[model samples]
Target: IDGEQINLSIWDTAGQEEYDRLRTLSYPGTDVFMFCFSVVKPDSFDNLRDKWLPEIRQHCPEAILMLVGCKNDLRFTLFNKFQNQERKFVTSDEGEYMAAVLGAHGYFEVPSFHHSKVAPIFHEGAREALRRRR
Candidate 1:
């Protein structure tokens, strides 16, 4: 991106059980893996460990892994609304801790609805992929 044109093909796999077999087929040429989960949904984070990470490790062990916490804007809006109502929102500390535990190359908290916030994550990911290629 910094004067060099980088082409990145991203495949977002379906978490449904039916797509498990087909998802593995997309792993062969993967340069980097963005393992994303919603900060609003704890179950999604659990799946990152129990499902996504293990599957990616099995298929593309050398791929650079980036841990992304999605819907970050919700942490302020929806999450704060539920704070005293018995709901738990994932903190940045927790996300960073998990990323460290899983050996992720980068960690980002992005709001899906905000393009400005999301762009840097992909740009950085492309840079990481390019670095690894050399």
Candidate 2:
């Protein structure tokens, strides 16, 4: 990150109800919380507010929060296929707006399958964590 080497460890527990207690245990040393949702699923975006954010705030209040819209490729594909129908996917503008509303450190739309494209998310996250530490 910015010519410095950063050691980052990520614990992605995407709201597993059965391991809610176990998940909270990993929150102690967390520097950044990447709250991710599918762009195709509006309900998942809602979960960021209805479920994830509150939990993260409760456990790690000072942690840097990032709003990530996953499966962005699917959003474009689905939208093209359903062009004549009603568009149900969440828009990029909406994701950015939510990030602002939640006071997230960053907002990213990524296709999980592509490692090259996904690298920025972690790089930016590490940069933010380093910035916060200073």
State each model's CA lDDT, in order. Answer: 0.88, 0.89
Query: What residue runs in model 1 are displaced by over 4 Å at the alpha carbon?
Result: none
Give the Å shift of residue 81 in candidate 2: 1.7
Cand. 2 TM to true fold: 0.91
Q: In candidate 1, what are the lDDT values of residues 57-122, reduced to their tens digit?
A: 999999889999999888889856777787877889999898898899977998868878888989
Clashing pairs in 2: none
> For candidate 2, which ten residues in a row score worst on lDDT?
7-16
